[model samples]
Target: MYLKSIALVGFKSFGRKTELAFGSPIVAVVGPNGSGKSNVAEAFRFVLGEQSMKSMRSKRGEDLIWGGSPGLPRANRGAVRVVFDNADRLLDLDFKEVVIERVVYRDGQNEYLLNGTVVRLKDVIRLLAGANIGGSGYQIISQGEADRILNASPKERREMVEDALGLKLYQHKKAESERKLGETGVNIDKTKSLRRELAPHINFLRVQVEKIEKARELKEQLAAKLNEYLAREHAWISQEDARLSEEIRMHETELRKLSESVRAARGARGSSSDAALAGLQGKLAEREGKLAAARRESERLARELGRAEGALEANNVTVEAIVPVPHVRNFARELDATVSELERVDDIARVRSVLQDIRSRIKSFIEGLSGAAPVTNEEVKQQVKSLADSLARVREEETNLADELESLRKGIAEARESGFAAERDLVALEASVREAQSKLGGVRAARENIAEARRRFEEEVREGIALVGAAVHSWEKAEIPPGALSEERSVQEKRRRDIERLKIKIEESGSGSGEAVVKEFTQTKERDEFLAKELADLEASAASLKDIIAELEKTIDARFHEGLKLINEALKNFFTKLFGGGYVDIRFVASQEDTRIGGSLGRGARAYLYRTHFFDDAGESSALPRSRRDRRRAR
Candidate 1:
């Protein structure tokens, strides 16, 4: 590969755009002193990634720019571009032409471009190193630098010789490898530190995860126990409730039947006794009324008879003496008629009239008797006898009525007694009904108890479901031990207690936020693993770089020695032709003291040349004495 063209703008003496194209293998630029010929060479160095201002004959970036001269304004920036011909693929680029550009601003900032794309100085250097080209290499020789190889120190000469032999590429690779190794070591250290920082937190999260797992296990166990206990309790309560319901239904039915029987019995007793008593009481009342009437009639008749007897005793006259017999008989008959009419009359007025008629008749009879007739005492006696008989008959009628009333009262009393007996039987039946009702009440109360127990069981089931999730609904499918229902309530209660204890333990464990903790732990663990992997990779890369550096070192040393030998042979032939005499030898010598190179201390290779029998071979040919200047240069 060879430089095909160079373009410069505002670079030192080139204030305007300029381009130089080298089409042939040899090209020369001739100029007088004070012209800008050397500027072209420096421009090449500037474009090829030169970093030292002193090498470019400048103190800073701005010095590389044109300081305006004679009607020309100063340039603000300087730029140089070098194009390479890559037809032989000597440079690691795909194009037939490679252009490298560098620009310097007055602010001491520099920019690099590769193929017109912005890049870094390191990129340009690396790319150039691949083509065995560098800013400070033997590719460019200045006027005074023609003898610089002879005057340069052995170490400098060795570097120049290495550059000529294309060993600079290996040097660049070695340097780059060393730099990468150092950076990789730093990354490894950082990775280790990160892992160390993550350790404690990961451990803490692990503990929390373990606690969450334990709580989960306890919850599972609690759920199982709850299922068994609740299922059995529900079954038992259901059975008891059903049994109590049946008992209540039976007792209710029995009580209803008994009540009906008591009602029927009461109805029968009431119907019979009430009808009998009512009939007998009515007959007795009727008979008593009849007896009272008879008595009253008898008393009236006795009164009438006494009055008649009094009237007869007062009169004390024999009817025969007082009047004619027929007349007296007629008077007596009239008097008797008057007395019967008075007794039969219910109106006072008619009775009074009848009595007045009798009085008037008696008076008339007396008058008539005064004239002629007399009455018999037998008529009076007859009338009195009739009234007495009437009284006696009424008395007998009252006696018969009293007897009938007494009989009727006896029947009524018997009816009342029968009613009482019926009442007693009704009371007994009602008592039996009450007893049945009492039994039903007890059964109902038992049913209420069972219902309450069922309610409590349902509540427990809900609580279990809340605590242990929907697993509580699975109680129907739970495996129960044989005869579990036959066990005492205490056993079920114990199981319930176990469940409660486990629930409390689970509550105390945590709020189940361990999922988040576990997630975080997983992420942290993954990060740690990734970092560990990265550290391993970095370590591997550093090891590989070291191996590459070692290999490059070996190759560089071997190739450098080989090139040095070839250069020495060329030097011998050239020396003979140039000086027309003597012999020259070039060889490598190791320095006794360590030298600092590329930021590392190492033994340095110094090139030494010995010339004999030309002009200074005054004594026997011996190895050229080491000059103090050369030793100083080596140091």
Candidate 2:
């Protein structure tokens, strides 16, 4: 695989997003020195999982991003992406094109991604390994390391050459296999050690587990018995609940009908009483008005009667004070005798003569009374005259008073009748009110009794149906109310106590103390068994890895010898072409010693080769022969 395109954004020199597309092979990027041309190569290294900050020409994440120019804004982050053409499937991905990206923030945080999916740096490195690309491979020969392979140590040169020769992928595989093989060996040892440690515990748990199994069997039997009773009780309660609910409903319905009747009766009585009361009150008010009129009349009659009596007394005194004609008392008899004598004289002449004679006598009497010392003073005379007139008026008033007294008597009798009628009607209305109150009291008493019964029944239903179980304890809803159960509660209580006691006994015993102990025992046994199988699998894998390593070593040795032969021939011809009469030869070292420090292993030497040349002039001192002391560490 090869780089097809590159994209940079907010990088050290590429503040604005920039992209480069390479459609042809052997694309070269040339620019003046210090013109950020090297950044492009570093960008590739960054995208391909280079972790060395110094190598990217940055000491920190923020330094890798643009620090702002004269008129440009600073970037908060830097990103670089490189795309590869993977149509040949040379890279280990299922895509025609693979894009790898890296981003660094000013806060020293960084991330890697593959085709927009976030990934770790190790994933990117592992993916690129199969493509024979590495951070220090020959695919990217930076100017500073133009001859890096030539100067690299034996091990370092081995890595570089392997990439150039397309063997880096195999080496990576070998490394992974070796790492797995080593881990397998460690796991095998741990399994053996763990099994040894758990043996005593497993034996102890076995004894306890046997006891727990027996307890569990007893528990199962108890649960079965309990469930059977609960089921029966549940069914019985359900049936009885329906019946009780129906009965209660009927009772409530009857009570409601009775209550409605009572209310209706009350309404009727209230209307009747109200109407009666209004009529009685009106009659009472009317009678009171009539009584008030009667009282006023009585007072007026008494005042008139009193004034008449006073005037009559004064008249009597006046009559006495006046000198009455001396024959006034005898004159009334004389007049009566003359009127009788005139009646005896039937002749018209004789009758007229008799009336004249009577008139003459009355005149004689008045003249005699006036001449006799009667009213000799004019004042006395006027008084006597006034007394007479007053006496006449008094008589007239007395006549009028008698007639008025008769009418007042009639009015009093009518008012008495009206009062009696009102009183009788009031007494009847009061009787009705009392009767209605009595009926209302009885209805209220009945309603209270029924309401109390309903309350008691509701409480009984709530208590009778409540069921407590092992897993759940809450009020269970029934569509309708239920009646009390027939089964004695004592039997259920006894069974419950038995269940509780059994549970307590299990807790006291060492076997099934708690759920956690059972879980631990089961998990521990499973883990021990799993470890045994894992140990067998790991041993098998370790053996297979050893065979693979041996095969790889043999293949590498034979190939290395053949590669040396071919390179020696090519160098001989290349020296002849460059300078006449020159010979060159390359040969592999026989063996290498692994370095050690204080009995601990260090770096191992990898088989490599050196080239020799003879030009007859004998110059350049054998091209500075390479050795372990002079070689630097590999990239």
Candidate 3:
């Protein structure tokens, strides 16, 4: 690959766009001193990723850009491009012509481009390294720099030789590898320290994890026991509810029977009451018939008494004997009490018997309290006897009527009493029913409350079980708490308490270091493994660097020795021709001087000395610019 062309724009002295093509293998750039010829070389350096401003004849990025000559417009930035002819593809480029560019901004920023695509400075460096080209190497030599190698310090000289021998790439690789190795060592130390810090925490987490596992196991067992207890409790509650319902149904049935009986009694009374009352009234009318004949006898006696009033005044005649009632206050009170009791007693037989007793007492009382009277007039006695006989006849005919009327009265009274009793019983039965229903309602509310509480408890238990069981495949069939057969409420309560306690234990055991701890451990281990792998890779890179550096050393040695040998032969021929048969010799100033690495190890500058033998009839040594200053200038 050879440089084909170079383009410059706003670069140093080249303010406008400029292109220079180099088609021939050899091209000479000739110009007077200070005519911007050196700027071309600086441009090459700039494009090749040179960072040393002094070497580029500039102190800052702005110095590389055009700063407006007297008659030219000021430019803001600068760019330089070099094109390569890569017909053989030696530069590993697909294009026949490859372009590399570098741009400097007014600011300190700079950019590199390959074939118009923005790239990095290192990309340019690496590409040049492939072709044994460098920004300050043998590729671009100047007349003034011809003796640069001889003027260089021993260490710099050695570096020049290495660059010339195309070992710069290897050196760069070795340096980078060493840098990475150093960084890797630091990282390894940091990783070890991190592991040291985490070790105790991890161990603590391990203990916590063990406790958490135990807690989880306990929770699973508690949940299983709770499920069993809850199911049993539900069954018992259901049975109790059914029993209460059945009892309520029985009470309701009895209430219905009582209600029907009361209704029947009322209906019977309602149907027969008016008819019985009317029949008693007719019997009473018939029983009162003797009073009419007694009334006529009384009227006739009244007239006779009226006529005999005058005669009776002269003769105080005796009347028939009559009894008087007793005047005792207790008798009146007793009579009132009997009458009240009789009012209450709706039974016809009872009323009649009580009335007869009361009448006999009243009559006896009157007789005891008052004296008897006798009939005074003879006509009045005859009239009384006749009326009494008539009354007796009438009473005998209606005696059966009295019995019938009494029977009817008794039936009506019994019916009335039965009706009253039935009403009382109905009222009492309604009250009892209301009381029973109120009690039943309370029982139902309590039962429902219990049911709701049970449902919520069981749901919470199942939810807890599900949470624990999600982590355990065989959790459903796990063993539960002991002895929970018949006592459902106690069993469920125990399970609930156990669940709460287990949860507390779980919290106390450090829930933090459970699944997360496992994940962290796994991730940390992976990170450690990755670090180890990275360390190994860094070590391998260091080893490869060592091999490459050794190889570069060997290459420099072989190439330097071989090149010096060929140069010495060419020098001998040049000396013979320049001075015509002069015997000349060229050798290192010291044995170490011949070797760049070995010579640079010494204190003095690495150099070469020459001796000449002038042959003029007799073989003799002749001087040729023997001063050190002249020799250095020639070099």
Q: Which candidate should be chosen as best, given lDDT against the real structure?
A: 1
The TM-score between candidate 1 and the true structure equals: 0.63
Candidate 3 lDDT at 303 equals 42
lDDT of 2 by residue, 1-635 (tens): 67789999998899999999998977878889887899988888778877888888788878889889988899999999888999999888999999999999999899998989999876787788777686664666777685665555555655555565555555555666677777888888988999889888887777778777767665565555445444444555555556555655665565555556656655655565556555655544444443333344334434433543454355453333444533344555565565556434424455455545655665565465445543223333443343344334334434444555555555555555544554455455555555555555555555555456456444433422322224121223222234335667676557556755655655565453346666777888998898888878888898998777656556655655566566668878888788775576644454455521111122242544443435444543244245554334211
Q: Which residue runs of candidate 3 sit more than 4 Å off their true CA positions? A: 23-26, 186-223, 244-501, 510-635
lDDT of 1 by residue, 25-131 (tens): 98998899878898998898888877888878889889999999887899999999888888898888899988889999999899999889999877778788777
**TM-score list, all predictions:** 0.63, 0.47, 0.54
Q: Candidate 3: minimum summed lDDT over ten consecutive residues — where?
A: 318-327
Instruction: Evaluate all candidate structures by whole-model CA lDDT and list the values in order.
Output: 0.76, 0.61, 0.63
* Clash number for candidate 2: 1
Candidate 3, 1-635: lDDT as tens digits: 88889999999999999888897878888889887898998888888888999888888999999999789987999999999988878675688878999998999799889999998876777677767775555677766677775455444554655576565665565455556655766776776677677677667766766666786676667556555545555555666667667766775676677667657666765667656656765655544442333333334434433444443344455322221122234455565566456445545466466555655665564354335443435433333343333334334434644565577667667756766676677667667667766766776776687678668756765665455654333334544445533555675577667767766676676564367766776676666667667667766765675566556545655666675566567767887888776555433344334544331234353443443334443566543443466567757
Best first by lDDT, ranked: 1, 3, 2
lDDT-wise, the better of 1 and 2 is 1
Q: How close is candidate 3 to the true structure, as a TM-score?
A: 0.54
